[model samples]
Target: MLREVVTTRYVTPLREGGSLPAIVEADDLGMYVVKFRGAGQGHKALIAELVSGELGRGLGLAVPELVTVQLDEAIAKGEPDQEIQELLLASVGRNLGMDYLPGSLGFDPVAFPVDSEQAGRIVWFDALIGNVDRSWRNPNLLRWHGRLYLIDHGATLIFQHNWPRDAGALEKSARKAVNLEDHVLARFAPDLRAADAQLAPMVTSEAVDAATALIPDEWLVGEPGFDSPDDVRRAFRDWFAARVRAPRSDWLPELAR
Candidate 1:
């Protein structure tokens, strides 16, 4: 279960992504990057962020701490920006928040060198979640305190967007291999085969369940084809569990030459 906090103040809008997540101070007195539930991406994006972020953390990746934030429309009263004020009004209630890392620098491949093993692990993990945003153009990676931290997983688990699909499509999409040509760290990842060997066993049913468990029921409610949020949760858990059990060549992307 995720820790919950109420928004104490609306800090500033983060205009990096289309969803327009913002920096806000919580009642806990911690600063966080809050992803609004009413963003264009909607609740599914927040679901992806929670699941994928927690799953990456489960795999020993450096992802920021995630929390559930309670937002109130009145919190935005002092904001002069009309767009941000409207966004805050729409996002009242439960939203997703990530611990803010101050003074963190955006990752620049030329400026930092990543060793092969760690790079391979990240690539392998991204492939599992079908993350498409981690490219050279927009590497959703942050370098804080000399460590790389993954962020912004709203674009992942795309299959969930169109629920109620046939079993065959689900199977095929789940096993689809990721393309490494435009991946930000493709060149740094030389041995994805070794990464599979090391990380595959770790993506067990327990891990999948743990990650999916973090998803809020509110986010899964009213999902098409599923009678209840638990059903949706079970579907996600089973999908990931089955995907990891498949033959490596079926889903794992090869290291770029």
Candidate 2:
């Protein structure tokens, strides 16, 4: 869990990020880049981002540390989540985690510190859940301390239920199919780890319940989190175990188990 403010003040926004993520200081906690969720997707993307970033780090990848912090309306824009916005405003501070990727450079293939081999590791994870956020133009990767780390996954694993039924011509597909380049498919192609399977269980009934507690009640007034975190967990499980693993890929099954 994280708070809104601490001993230090929010210096300013990190101008480099397209998503407009801000950089703030915490006397005891250090620096963090916080991103707010808005109209296009939802706050669930932020949750997914936290989960994926944390899980990747757990897998021994050089991902930045994750933290949660609340964003003020002055810095937050385009967020249609009145409930979350109000929540962020109310409790002085909320649990918006941060992933410290200091000295890390933004997305760039040629300048990337990672070898072509490890590229597949990330691609494999993205493909499993249709993460299209990390792309050539905006690869959400950074190089820090000579290690390549991923970030800003607030665009992956979009919930199908969120898609608008009347969003005519805007109907989107589920997080089942992902587009990967030939080289990416070549590397981890042979052994795409069960990133989804390994990550899904941690987002369990109990975990969701706990997370729901952190989220403001207004945001969860009738949300699946407040009513039944298990429902949200089940949505993730149904997607991962059913479609994400529908393919007979070894990595999928290995993770599924």
By lDDT, who's the top model here?
A: 1
- For 74-153, candidate 2 gives per-residue lDDT tens digits of 53333355654443343334445465666667656655434434654566566644667666657776777777777776
- Give the RMSD in angstroms, all C-alphas superposed, for model 2: 7.4
Number of clashing pairs, model 2?
A: 8
Please report the candidate that would top TM-score against the real structure.
1
Candidate lDDT scores, in order, read 0.86, 0.51
What is the number of backbone collisions in each predicted candidate, taken in the order shown? 0, 8
Backbone clash pairs for candidate 1 read none
Candidate 2 lands at a TM-score of 0.65
Candidate 1 stretches with Cα past 4 Å from truth are 164-166
